[model samples]
Target chain A: MAAAFTAIGGKWKLTLLYWLAHGESHFAGLRRRGAPITPKVLAEQLRELEADGLVERVVTGPVPARVIYRLTPYGATVLPVVEGVRVWGEAHLQRTDGQSVSDTAMSCASSIV
Target chain B: MAAAFTAIGGKWKLTLLYWLAHGESHFAGLRRRGAPITPKVLAEQLRELEADGLVERVVTGPVPARVIYRLTPYGATVLPVVEGVRVWGEAHLQRTDGQSVSDTAMSCASSIV
Candidate 1:
């Protein structure tokens, strides 16, 4: 549980996981998908997730050095928990317009009370 | 959901909440239940939890200065999620002997992979 929490609890980690779960994604794809995220932060978080073993990094080719981030078995185990959190988040995470989940990360739990 | 996650995702927050779920408790009660927890760390965590609004602080007497921590309504909302995490943790958190959960906090999600 702690691994799962730590894996998904970083600044851009949850958003990164959310994107990767859909399918394999390159770092650029994620950068395009999420605004307010710089390429450096994206790469840094991907490395952290990969090193933590939550994300699998695969090199696709030698010519272009294409890399893809995929969810590993460990990452799969926490997807359900993440889904639960997402469902719960959508319900209460909209208090301040349609802000991103990370922006309101601390609000969802506090609002229920 | 983010609120729920953050609320329960602290270092000793989940364990503290689990004990509190059973009933209101003084600081000493929690320290006794969980071994290797210093009185100072316990007090610090309790104060943090209280500040987060997950635990309610009450002063009971004028003479002896009794204080008990209770779960707030916000805290109650996240208990289900915590229970889910605990159940998940118990299933996967026992690879390294019967050491305390604090020692194995990062192992639970990692093992699932």
Candidate 2:
């Protein structure tokens, strides 16, 4: 329960999954994508993802030691799950203010400002 | 996708879901459950859930106006998805450190401390 949810629930983690789900990318390449996290955080997230078996790490050791990451078959399974979330988001996109869920209601009820 | 993900992704959201999945509760009643949040935050979350149609709010007027919230049929759909996450979490519970996901991996690899 916690694992899979945590897998998708990581801050900037979902975005990483969204990107990796597109295809594999090396560390620098991912950083260039302008992820909303620092390189240290990014690398940390990727490594953890790898250990959890949700991602595959390929290290090409020749000189600079290139390390690339991709989602595993299990990670791919989250597509439908992620898709489920995406569907929900799309349907409520306007009302959700792109934040997904009903944050709007709380925004209305509570003055978090 | 974003909507559903965000819905389930809210802090204390899943915990709320777990509680609602079992039964309904009101503002003060829920507070006594030892939720790891403030009364203000709980009411805010519930109101947001109500607006999202995931929760039905019952307001009884007389004095302070008691408002009790319960999950709606639409909100019920999230059960399977949350269950999916739960299954994933339980499967990896020990390794997950109760924080859910593989946060431990990052702890091991990156040492957030």
Candidate 3:
């Protein structure tokens, strides 16, 4: 359980992975997707995920290069878990009063299952 | 996503719920199950879970009353999510070098589904 939590335990790790499930995103794109996450924390979480082999960071172009983040093939293995969390979150939000995943991520997560 | 994480997020909420899935336990018992959790944090987490309606605290006896913590019927709703985390953790542990859930919780969690 700790391992699972460690891999995706933080507030933003799963959310980041959820966003990546749609396709790769540049650092700014991901930052925009989860607007509340600070750049420092986002970079840290992305680094941790990359270390865990669930996310990969790629550099595109030369100077003023764009950094892309995407799920690795090994990372794909965690999609089911991500979907479970997303679906549960959506349902819980409906039951209680809370913010929810965006429609795009919601539909994409549902379809992935 | 925020709602779901709020309900069972944190390092210990899901684990607390996972232990309770076996049966109700008192403060000491819960402490024993999760040895590393500080008393203050355990109380706080239990209080939060109770406040969220996922866990219930029953007082048995008077004078040095026994406090038993158990999952509310609604709390059972989060079991699938907990199970997903546990199963994923187990698999991730096998693949990586990480701690695994105790045999008791592992077998019980497996039997739950």
| Model 1 chain A lDDT-worst window of ten | A104-113
Model 2 whole-model lDDT (C-alpha atoms): 0.59
* DockQ of every candidate: 0.19, 0.19, 0.38
Off by over 4 Å in 3: A1-4, A63-65, A100-111, B1-4, B34-36, B63-65, B100-111
C-alpha RMSD of candidate 1: 7.3
* DockQ winner, 2 or 3: 3
Give per-residue CA lDDT, model 1, range A1-113, as digits (tens).
Answer: 23323344455565566566778887777766635667887788788778766799998986453887899988677566555544544553353244455543233322211
lDDT of 1 by residue, B1-113 (tens): 22333434444666676667778987776666634557876788788778766799998876353988889987676666555555554544343233345544233322211
Give per-residue CA lDDT, model 2, range B1-113, as digits (tens).
Answer: 22334555554565566567767767776776653568887888777777777888877765453777778887887666666555554555455455533344221111111
Superposed Cα deviation of residue B112, candidate 3 (Å): 3.7
- lDDT tens digits, residue span A1-113, model 2: 12334565554555566667768988877777643458888888787778777789987776464877888987776665555544554555555565533443211121111
- Highest-lDDT candidate: 3
The CA lDDT at B19 in model 2 is 61
> How do these models rank on DockQ, best leading?
3, 2, 1
Estimate the TM-score of every prediction.
0.55, 0.58, 0.78
Please provide, for model 3 over A4-72, each residue's C-alpha lDDT reduced to its tens digit, 9 standing for 90 to 100. 456776657777777788799888887665356688888998998898889998887775547788899
